[model samples]
Target: MAWKKDDLFLFLFIFIIVSLYPCHGNFSQANNKQPNFRNASSFSTMPNSPYDYIVVGGGTAGCPLAATLSKNFRVLLLERGGSPYGNNNISRLENFHQTLAYSTPTSPVQRFLSTDGVFNHRARVLGGNTCINAGFYSRAEPSFVRNAGWDEVLVNESYQWVEDKIVFLKPAAPWQSAVKDGLLEVGVTPFNGYTYQHINGTKFGGSIFDNNGFRHTAADLLAAGNPPNLQVFIHAPVQKIVFDTRGTKPKAIGVIFNDENGNQHEAFIKTDEKSEVILTAGAIGTPQLLLLSGVGPKEDLQKLNITVILNNEHVGKDMADNPSNNILIITPEPQNQTLLQVVGITTKGFYVETSSGFGINNDSIVTVKNGNMSELKEIFRGGTILEKIIGPLSKGNLSLVNTNVTSNPTVTFNYFAEPEDLRRCVAGVSLLLEIAKTRPVKELMGNLSYTDEMLLNMSLNANINLIPKSGNETKSLPEFCKKSVTTLWHYHGGCIVGKVVDRDYKVIGVGNLRVGDSSWFDVSPGTNPQATVMMFGRMMGVKMIRERLSAG
Candidate 1:
């Protein structure tokens, strides 16, 4: 079969039309629960400045941590980005692609290209990555908790606290239903049904998107806490952590940040000995801030002319991004837009997921949001079968791009850098090809015919396909794994546990400073890390409260 120029033109026309009109199902009336967020530009001076706890980066973890701590202590949560409330792009599931397509200075997502030639985006909004990510929620594997040396009972309680406020349980949509059946057909596993617990089986996980198609982000968790004790400031990027060197060992006393207006402000800890400064600045921001504040490798700091405080060589090391590869299929009929819902957790070390009904226009050329025009790719439309390896063995390091804390650091996940990673990816792709032949998936694909040109052009659009006109699927798999590899945006590490931070999450040599986010994870938790990251915030907050009371 060959696609003529006329056929290609007709397909493009349909794609543009379908993209304009997104599927808007029944909209259920729901209450909007958010905190009273003030612009950092509003106040040049801090009101009741000295606080018991200062939580930087009011993201997926920061919001919950600050909210929980405020119940017993005065907490100030600083966010470099604006609030997610009232933003239609952030609130609606249908506008997911549009939100990512956004490329303004104040966009909810900030794009960055890894030195390894992979493009990725980091959340730049108060809700953190939850505002920009596919809203799948699942708890960490019990093994992850045990390995991290966390209290199992408290871990479950913290997970419940986060679920109660923000998580919603729902059945899969039409396309997702087909994917679920396809996975089962391919013998991915016994069906586990709806559960948030991470297990090796095909199951329906929890969603941050409710039944009404509204996305609930971590910022909403703030409403559950004591509001009087919590003060949230948006558009306030911390330049660095302020330290007092007069002590026998350097102590974190406060933080210096700039408002949206570029006005500098300093916030200090309260007189309480238990008061501390916490960093929830995600994987990248956490490490970048530490390095900028003269707390990284001595040689790197000396190169950058930064004063050396603690010569911890592991501050920005062991950065890992889950290597993701997928195949895109053009459906015969327009499908309803879906985010990640049903997932296939294979016995092997990879997870499978799917998303459908996202249409892209001719003008929608994708580029890194960091003003790099040379690296451009096309956004593919229609349904996709995506797989990402769990616990990628390969790792890389992050270094300073510049002294500016807002600028993205240079990072490379070195995807497939380890032989084990490639092996798992090849296995995952083999299973996906098998799943595509399943009855349920074939039915969803319909009588659609694609020519060699169509398949080749699809890859140009940054979508991978193992199926060829005629070739050995086995041999082509390794090449496909390398060429098609991209980020799942599930990156973690840098300020990792046991290396940079202790089991209690305190920076090894730094006093009164703690990290409580995915940055502390040695392994990316579960298939989706948001649930675990949110749970961690609540867990740490509870621990801090207990520690303070007992210490007194």
Candidate 2:
């Protein structure tokens, strides 16, 4: 996704403007508080003890995976970032943009600009992207589960497990309610009210935020686990997976990681041959670690001077991200702060979602008199209607920036690189444009008269002019898509299934090593992968527990 000048300005207004405020909000769910039995500690305080399972990365899937495994085995969960317990920016709905904007050397949100020149982020907190996302929680399509080789019954069970602890049925705010009505008004189909199911048509999905506007992250899922058996260490980053190469099949036995103070420690697995070292370090982090551990393409490892453990060519290939395009609807009326709750799922290969506030002060306004945009005092009161291309076919790759595990690897998603993907974007954007003109949505804007002709012509008073100038609407639409495309932050691939990992999520050609995160996804499950990813953690853990018990 390429960033345009206007997109940059819009992003800045949303993220950077209000970053100066300190985070402040209480967690609504009591489970969101770290439990007494959760042996969570900073890395310096952690002892180098052997564990039955060592799970690197305490983010979305990792936290739940580790928690579930602890039911019958000793588990150690290592996170590169601190806890999200008291971070108001991460927990409060109103501070959404500020949390993403408050980037620092050790901040929970790690900022990275892709090689394609589009800014992206990686979550460094215990809850992973759950700490920074818009909090929209929707399940994977049933077809997606079957295609991914997951048990359909188990998938539902796992989803219910996570929902019981964290997911909430969000009450639709006025703007979201209007947007839902607008989606129906535009033929998005029969409304599925307040559902977690990913289905066609308009519906209000689940959210991690409670009615009090406080977020409950995946970390809260740990409360369901046998806590006495789980040890969670924050600010502990694994440098590489230590392999025992003496056996016929190279086996992952331990991990070498560094503490917050830069002290190295080694954690090994117990004597049980089934013990494993799992990487739930997210899509980018998992692949990067594989490459750094000399588990990727041999030539790449040779250049990095890392000893080859396993030369897997598919480790960092086929990276994909959902290409997103959004238009800020600057309403004259004061709209309440909102995150993505109401979603419009289209049969046309994309999804539509709306959000009202991103921490932008409503009093602030931007006046543009340059080029195609008219001189209108656009207030940031109204939210944005974002279109995400479903199942983006355009793919790319991820490679090492350096040997440093913490540094972001170079990635290119090649958004709209596929002609089919471009077609989808055009279709999705056209639908979004129509939705904006619907009576229900327009009524919320309070007479912000904007017709298709005015919007396409880039009229000053049209209130939607993010597209670049072109002679015709068709030519301009594609150009707008290419330049204005941004990430929904739903990027996945890297260590995809069949190629990098097997159906069981175990790393190919290696023993006792597995990846259990979005990195295992060949296709992003639904509009949001968080729900499925959390479910995956639970399902896999349950499977492992059953396998272990059955063996005995």
Candidate 3:
């Protein structure tokens, strides 16, 4: 056949029209607005092909881990919630509590109140707590890396990698400036400037939020990933890990996940010999899922009739939570909005931190009692200091329920179970009171007494007692703490490295299975922990790369 000039023109015209058709109806959305991501809404649409790595829970550690692995491997990152972008309640600092307290099924955070009555929230969305928490970012103390038996140089590199992606310098707001001065006056001296190290005394740390009020969360790490080789699915909750026990030791071959409408689908490792199933679900979620997958204390699983794959006693043990008290001091002046910046770290293992903008919308506050001081109206409309006892000697565990996605693990947070913890709390309260009485604080603040109605609004505690203020003696602060202290949402020691997983984060008893995230910490890192968690994820990414290249 001979081609003519007019025929060529006609073919070119038709090709241009189709290119501008303005529809990207296929999974390979090269021209769609959000081309690289997929909203996993139906079971039939899931990719039947296997991947080199299947990451569960697209959270703080999971996002970075998946992103880093995608550089050389085909990856599938599964998240339970929608993207962090275009969510006002998540992107803004003022809406922190609103996102936490919301009960919507699609909410990025699921709020939980423990058996001990400590209110907390777990991450349900991408970037995990970095998307919803206090936003105070600090690297783990060097002592922590040494204690965890990690190479310090490699740990430092991981910190740099994370900080380069999501962390930002937060300027001290006006209220935070006052807090810094107050900390200085109370002997928390030698400010460490705006750095991310967990140094002693008063210091300002990094934040996920930038100076322009935009959150650069762990989700941003995906930008550095190989888009063609990576597939991210949101609104797809993982149900279980399918096993192939034909081998001498059982091996994880694939996973079962549910779409948004509750239809189930399965995804498995690819033909690569190095393929793996990694779990970066947080402390509670990782252990709970393992228990559901027939791994945990054999007695507990047997009681629930769950088949036992491995009787790992350390799976859900040694759970610890940081307990804190919210000390509200009604101020004479309207306070400026402030995020977590200025921190007063004590040598006695407590943190005295301050925050403003207590005047969050009424919807964020769970209860609104107009009779007392109008909880519907903001009551803590003044300066507030959070006295957190970070070093709790008590321990707890996560118990299993029936095997259903809707069933939440029973979390037992036995806070203040040790007398030493109570004593440390008492010392923390005394230090906070001392700071409150300082000339700088007293200059603008009023009497530091809690009315009965005011005390009722703080939090739910099992035991509470308070002695009336006397002219001669300090009021019973420890008794007040037993009634009002709540979890700081810092939990650790669920699946420790030595017992549950190897130093490389590989499950010792299972082939091609690994666990990361906050659960792998042997002990409480005594910090916000998001940075530590992220750094460890980066380390895993680096290790996988090194090992693969070395094997070749």
Candidate 4:
């Protein structure tokens, strides 16, 4: 078997040339140019061709699900918004927060807006709301995850698996440290060693993870590996879900959507095969899509002149959101000093008090570390019952006011509806005020007065006045509470787990349909939701792959 040096060189050269050959004819040409589609809207034009899996909504969940499923199955991802990969406005972290206001008109980040006109938050871009999110990546509380009805083993395994993939970065800069220390002085505690945790607690410190290093998004995550079987269609709005009822089990055959040019087209599922159709279109879009396709409450559909396929009353009920109110205190003399500046300038802020409470019986309330007592007192006297209680208790529903899928759905969150909800909020605010007066924090507050004088000015002027209060104030606490109410933008729980989708995320009454987004959360995590959403998306993806493989 011994060969000469020339013979070995010739063999290697021939092997390299053969390996470079394309599997199909003209593969090299196709790789160099775009597909033969007439336009960007042509993806929906092909109604006869079927796909192995049709995922609606290429958002946080849809994008990840499509990317993962494409490893073994052909996936068709439909996105209502344009791509965010190279979009300048969405690519940068600083620009992301600014785009929140315009997400609904053009992006995929739009959720339900509050009726009081205080909070208008959502994203409508290709990356979903993550495009304009605060970008805090922390895991959910263990108790909260268990509440979703999933097994403990499954929940922990899912959390670890997702965290490894996303890999959130801790705050390493000094400015972040300053903010964290300031928050600590005011009684905000870190929860679960992560940013987003607890259903109703104040989070002082949060970790800043570069969402894909400025491109942190589902689109980027999925597009990076570039699997051959995956195809993503942007700016394609799913108009309807066509169902095949001939078989014993109802099957979603395909979807019909509209393109940027107002042209309609249908994308049929591949024939003779049962392809699972997942609806990761998010809380509002998914329900709206279902209702439009005649798969919602029977009476509601009849009113709209659409035939009902499934009468699921829980489709849009139980809407929940974290309504936040800020309690800004004037530091004695701008604690933004050298040490604080160094903390903020050098490293990401440190997270204090990761886990404080222990559950009594797994479901019962557990007493945890009480954050800064002085700050709690300030919040109590300054904030109102409406801000504390009713804001937390009120639940809203999403309904289709119009048939247009692109049109914004009517999202009404009856914030501050219940008296008890208001009462709880008042208690929480009272606690915050107490924390502000503590020695460690009070020492930092020099000459600045906490009174109703500054509140009156900010409420009247409609501007964020961070200035310290004057030493004089005769107005009562009740007076300031009435005029200085604000709202938080952390919305959650519209399509809750068990209430909307089953434990497996499969729609209760529908076949071949699933939801994996913030809407699936049983309750709001009382903190930033970016991390929680990513975890849920990851869990759903893993479960989906396992289920498909088992069936095959």
Candidate 5:
């Protein structure tokens, strides 16, 4: 094997080229043109030119939808937050909590405690919640999507486009293995090997976290976007959708927005007939924007002084949050790190999952169940069994805090307000406790908190309301769950499919306007909805492309 001079030179040149690259070719190829992703000011000074499509809120759904739409159309994506690129807290798996704890008003994640005291954060950045969530990725159930009146073929096939761009297989570590074993031991049943499909019984799923522990999100999906067709303006929040009513009914013609500097600007639709304003803003932002733009319930808009364009009663009603409770198990030693790898999908109306290597530093702060901040205790270093119960009967609503776009929309998840919801929580906690008692998990788990009186009654705050009766309150699992149940941030169905948007994702009464996001759910999917949100984004992208071709 003699090396020729030309061959040696060629190898050296390619080696040098890769070495000069920032990520050693580890990231998506489209990421090399990162200059295309920029602050809002870049577009703010440009002369007025209407986009073929305008997507508001460059979060989970918005990014993918806009990126896909930009393939042939001139798409303008307005993101309220900065780029997720180069942010350590967002990219690293270890800083999962750090991103959430970044509580500054301008932080990418907008931390808020709901009226019921459940802690949650909304993504203020480009990838949306995908940039800050637990990074679990699972496809929506086929049955669920079919019932939503989606094109069954498109819905099933579109997930690969998203999975290819961002989703990764989470390798099960010791903790995850134990979790899988524990779930199987407790008869969660029918072990399906590692899969992306939403299946019943126990399984291992994918995540957005790469093997190197870097996050790949909707931002990465932009890598596939045609740079010239796509223009993303970060730190620019859409204030309201502007409508033109000279025709049969009002159509969203443009939008009013503010740059990072708080300077106001306007952008409009250009591709006539097909020109559209899509709200990929999440549950909160999507409904909030629609309501603010005078397309909500009649009485609510009148009270807020917003001129009603459409009297649709279903804009922001039927809001539901995926209720989740964390059961922490103290390990004899620091367990291996992993995301939601092993999970139990039970017929009992709940799903059990595990999170390891949360890796919070001792000095890092934690927001308690009561919304008070305190230095994180050492006990949080262990593994966690995070359980989310489906089909909660407790649905809440969101409306205008005021006409001000910047004002946070008044929100209430209304967690556990329904007796059925409380019952599900009790059942979920009991199942997890049963799993914890299994030999595999028992070796590592210790101490589930509950009050004896509360356990006997299976009621929350009934006999044990602020009484602090003895017998190690921390041992009562039911009480701890009741006091500390939080949202998985898997909120959906705000602008529901049937009531708000049709199967094509078009808003019922509005012209040239569509809503595609987690909020479009007829009912929330059983798994983490990031994959589903991305699926909707992908579907909208495909639909728009098909419509354009047909019109031509």
Candidate 6:
């Protein structure tokens, strides 16, 4: 169905009702008064003994940092959102995606903004966006890692350590074969055992260990071990960073946060007499928090009447993001297949190099195939080879509008800003057209009426508008292409590495403050970033420990 603005709103409203109405029943069944395990009070509240290290944002990196750091130090983790321990929204994987989309506009889960003044999405809850994301995992490409100025030995060690800690796996069942066939036909290839592969013009592998299910997230990782030394404080928004200026070099001593009940409390990091602070609060939160604490651009701080501690102009400037657009192909039949049932193809020609020297330097392309008939006939049947020849590619980006800390900043992603991106997407769509011509898929296609108008409408908002349109043209391919554009939910690059933070993940010019999250990515990984974020988190953890030990 062509999703008109009204249709989109209706779908969203129904989704919201379905997701929220059921929560009341679940909440009634569970005791609400029981102290939430994710809150600061659930753990030791002895403010008398300050923690050895304090980590902010108990989501992707924060959770692991707390778990790993607690092995040697008393770690305090502060989270602004409530825990998803027994939340139904997080239990089932499919429900996770649905709930996430519904919560994007209103919930304080993740931050979202539109460059065209249209849409915005962001997660403000614990586990950050991970609690409600499509759980695709991938590590950074070796070349990408090398560019970060780290030694080969360190990168290898970090990858190996992270892989083990996260238990990375690959998809092996028939579903993988089916999806692979579909993608091969389209020309999009999978990454060759690298996280930072060129995606502009290549066919590569999609990141997946098993095509049957989603990977684990931060909550799953932390809950599995339940380490004793770590304390998680959820629903406590950090108001400001308390810095101790007594010494020549100012150090972040503690944090002040407001709980859900409107009560404020202060927690100090023992810092072993000189402890360090790690901010894994994600791209949006990390920058916002820093600005709120007067650590951003001097001019902007002055305008807000806030005192500037660090005059770093680049604190929130070099904002970048992978442009993501979604292309939905209507299958002739309703195949009882989930997203996991699909195969991923990573083509080599998709990624190209930009003037920038960053690895996977230019735009990234991802093509998802929809073959309902083939899937219905054989649960694992890879679509006919022709299907791969024509598939659609969606593109988007991460951008910042205003630098206000209180308001959720705009995050407009220019989904298909580059002509090359659209060319690749058009090719993918052509491939899908071929697949529809096949015998099995043809039967389904015959029953379905697909008009050029519908296709244009669907593709337009998907952000694939490279085709030119003439005022007099009807529903020509070029005209249809000219009318389409879209946005992606994957938010990244507000505080990229090398440009924003130093090689060790430390915010430059700031003493003892570091960031370890998706925001630290110098460029958006051409693929899903769950694994990459976790790996970087582990790497940051190692760096933090080493720095603290050396200082002590």
Model 6, residue 112: displacement in angstroms? 3.4
Each model's C-alpha lDDT? 0.78, 0.78, 0.70, 0.50, 0.72, 0.49
Superposition-based RMSD of candidate 6 using all C-alpha atoms, in angstroms = 9.6
Q: What's model 2's TM-score?
A: 0.91
RMSD of each: 6.7, 4.6, 13.7, 17.0, 11.3, 9.6
Give lDDT tens digits, candidate 5, residues 351-468.
8887665453343332333221132243344466757877667788887878887667777777777777777777888776676667877666444333333222222211111223
TM-score of each: 0.88, 0.91, 0.85, 0.71, 0.86, 0.72
lDDT of 2 by residue, 1-552 (tens): 786766556455444222211111234555355743222335445564678899999888998899899999989888888878878888887777767755687898888877766667899988898888877788998889878777788888988888878888866789889888889998998998878898898988888878877888888877667867887887888999999899787889899888777888788997567999999999899999999998999998899899999988888899998887765565666677777888888999998888775555556443333223432234356666778888889999999989999898999888888999999988887887888888888887675665554444432122222334344543477766776666777889899888888888899889989999998777788888889899989999999999989998
**Over the stretch 1-552, how does candidate 6's per-residue lDDT look in tens digits?**
466764454333222211111000111112222222456543445443677777888777776666667766777788877766566656454355455445432353543335544343455666565566544444455556667766666556755554543333333223234333444444445423322222332222222222333334465445422356667777777888887766766577778887666677888876544566788888677877777777777877788677777776666554544432222334333323233223233352222110001011112222223212222112111111111111112223332234443366645445445565556655544554443343543443345544434433433433222334353322454333334322233456656566668777777766667777777665554344555566666666666678678986
Query: Using TM-score as the measure, what is the rank order of every candidate, best first?
Result: 2, 1, 5, 3, 6, 4
Per-residue C-alpha lDDT of model 1 across residues 64-143, encoded as one tens digit per residue: 89989999999989999988888887787766656665446788878777877765678889989888776888888888
Tell me the tens digit of each residue's lDDT in model 3 across 1-552: 665654432232211111110000111112212325566774356555888899998888898889889999888888877788778777766555556545467788776657776555688887787777767777777788887778788889988888876677766777778778888888887787877888888888777766656566677777668887788888888888888777787788888888888877888997455899999888888888888888889999999888898889989887888777655545545566566777777787787777765433223232334213333234334556767776568878888777875567888768788888888888887677676667766666544444433433432211121213232212366666776665556787678777888988888788888997888765556356778888888888888988988998
For model 4, residues 131-204, the per-residue Cα lDDT tens digits are 65444444555666667656667656755544544434443332234333444555454321223323223332
Question: Who is ahead in TM-score, 2 or 4?
Answer: 2
lDDT of 4 at 504: 75
Top-scoring candidate (TM-score): 2
Error of 3 at 401 (Å): 1.7
| Ten-residue stretch with the least lDDT total in model 6 | 352-361
> By TM-score, is 1 or 3 better?
1
Query: Candidate 3: where is the Cα deviation over 4 Å?
Result: 1-35, 42-47, 271-273, 359-378, 446-475
In angstroms, give how far residue 68 of model 4 lies from its true place.
1.4
Off by over 4 Å in 2: 1-27, 30-32, 36-48, 364-379, 451-475
Deviation of model 5 at 460, angstroms = 12
Q: After superposition, how far is residue 371 of candidate 6 from its true place, in Å?
A: 18
